[model samples]
Target: MFVHFDRPVPGWEPADGIRTLVFLANLAAQETTGDTASSTSTERLVHRLVGSTVHDVLALALIDDLPVPPGSKLSDLGYPLVPATGDDDTELVDDAEGFLLLGLPLQEDTGVVEVEFILDAGYLPIPGEVLEAEGKHVIHRLLAEAERVARVIGRNTLQTWLLHSPDEPAGTGEFADLLREYGYLPGLTEIQGFVDIQSNIATTAIGESLPQDASLRAEIIRDLCVPEALIPGLIELYRLASVEVPHGSLDAEPVEWTPRRLHQAAKRVVTTERSMLSVLLIDDSGVIGLSEVTCHPGSDPDVLEQGITIIHPRARGRGLGLLLKRELLHAVATELPAARRIYTSCASVNSAMIAVNEALGWRVLSGGSGWQKHLPTV
Candidate 1:
């Protein structure tokens, strides 16, 4: 039995939120050791973003007749009812199995639906064949809802994308296998790498001097707030960077980072209390190179994920990429005293950025693959 809602389950409470945080933390620990954060930190985060309208969130829950206490596991709940007709008058069940959430950022028109499955992985009473059938049914219901929303939002097409661990790879893990069985084709293979900056800070000192005629100055933006005046420059620099090494997408398409879209993203990061540290290299012509890293509050506060490092085409051949990265590393070490390690991912074909990361002493962490399914337009 599955119930889909536009928001969190109607009767969801604080206890359920805590249970969810615990479940997710445990999952993160399994994927990467020592990556889990304290409950206190996570609780603060849940309170902040639980009601956010920044994304169109859809949740699928399993429900049954039993009355369960708050924070109980999904498997412990009674069996679910058959899929509903997905109308406004759908009955709200009394108790629900934990849910799987899918969200699409309202700010970005990319039409990529991000997945966040919050259900427990414990076994159920159904036979393997029956369970598989139930899983397919869940996927279909979710896709149908996603497509409806896309149509309402005026999108001609959309995709559902998720990342799986290296061990799972493509066509192997349970979820991956399920998606493949349901027509979600595998996409990009990304290589993840990490470095313990405490011991490897010296590695960032590449000793590459900037070109004498470049006249560029590098500065750190600790507050994640980009001044209104610099937005144009940042956009230009990002555009040039994308042309050289485009941002990764399921279809390997380029992104047009408009001012409004960039501002919206920056606001979201700031509101979430996540650190978006950037080092921008500016010359008289404006921003020519940029490097960024982000760390989400309550989720391995010490682990910063590398965002992007880009240098204008004209700025290339002058070691600007290394210069910008080194500056960014210094900023991270100074502002984030708790920072211990930084992780970054590069597409299997992105040799330039991979070389930059390797030059900074980053070792391979794991491999991840993106899987996407294109939804048919009605």
Candidate 2:
């Protein structure tokens, strides 16, 4: 007869005459390694056999932890329980009426610490099935017993059961009803899903690049403050570069990089250079304004020439781009006297950035396309 149980008992065995099946499986592994083998071999065998059983027990324990009315079906605990089978019949025994007990290993230090229950899915009554009084009592008793078993297992516990007919309408109805009855609150459930996705993104290298400056970074915390008009030009530049390189293309000009954020990033660098006597550049209206160019104690001479830019759009036509770049280079040599190779990236499509860099004798370190995906919550 199909038998089911959901509690831990001392020296418990399955009631469906399958307890020997599990014991023999464990025995086979032990025998293969030789009973007289080293301690490690025996330990490995024991862990493999027991670790699996523990998971089943923990699954049940989790179900038992759910807050539900006493007469609820096993499925009403937010997860379904399924039957377990083994080869041995003699060791299996029907216990506490409809309950069947299965053997689980305990660490030596903690005697018989955990018991795993394998329920008979066929015998377990479903919600709205008009379970007899006896069947209801048995389920409640086993659930109560499961709580004690969980405590014995230790602070962390897990239980797992397989559903034989998950796709069947009967099983689906029971499963869905159970989840609704005992699942985490709606808000909490949504939060858990968000945490799962966000945690992974937070680990990427790009995500780690928070502005180094704390105070100035607050100004451009959101993308809306960025100049929306410049976005079209930026996107076109990105698209042209993609065509030229066919690969590594920028997916789209980032909508997140606001002018305030850029200012904050620049400010961080400026603050660092201030103590070390470095140069800063602000280009606007086709004119390059030298914000700072100075020499400081023990400052490297090569960095001074690297801090310069040509204003975009307006600076495109006049040869003023080359003139501004050359002037900055000269100022680095005569003023700060400490600078190194300049570095910058331009869209492969932006001949202007490329020309200015070339005129200043800057070599292209690397160039590639980049892409980005914007995710919106539904």
Top lDDT hit: 1
lDDT of 1 by residue, 262-349 (tens): 7777777766667788888888877788888878766677778787788877667877786677777777888886888777777778
TM-score of every candidate relative to the true structure: 0.71, 0.26
Alpha-carbon runs more than 4 Å astray in model 2: 1-308, 312-316
Worst 10 residues of 2 by lDDT: 186-195
Model 1 worst lDDT window (10 residues) = 76-85
Clashes (N, CA, C under 3 Å) per candidate: 3, 24
Residue 322 lDDT (model 1): 68
Error of 1 at 203 (Å): 6.7
lDDT of 1: 0.58
In model 1, which regions exceed 4 Å deviation? 1-15, 25-29, 32-54, 65-98, 123-174, 203-214, 227-229, 240-266
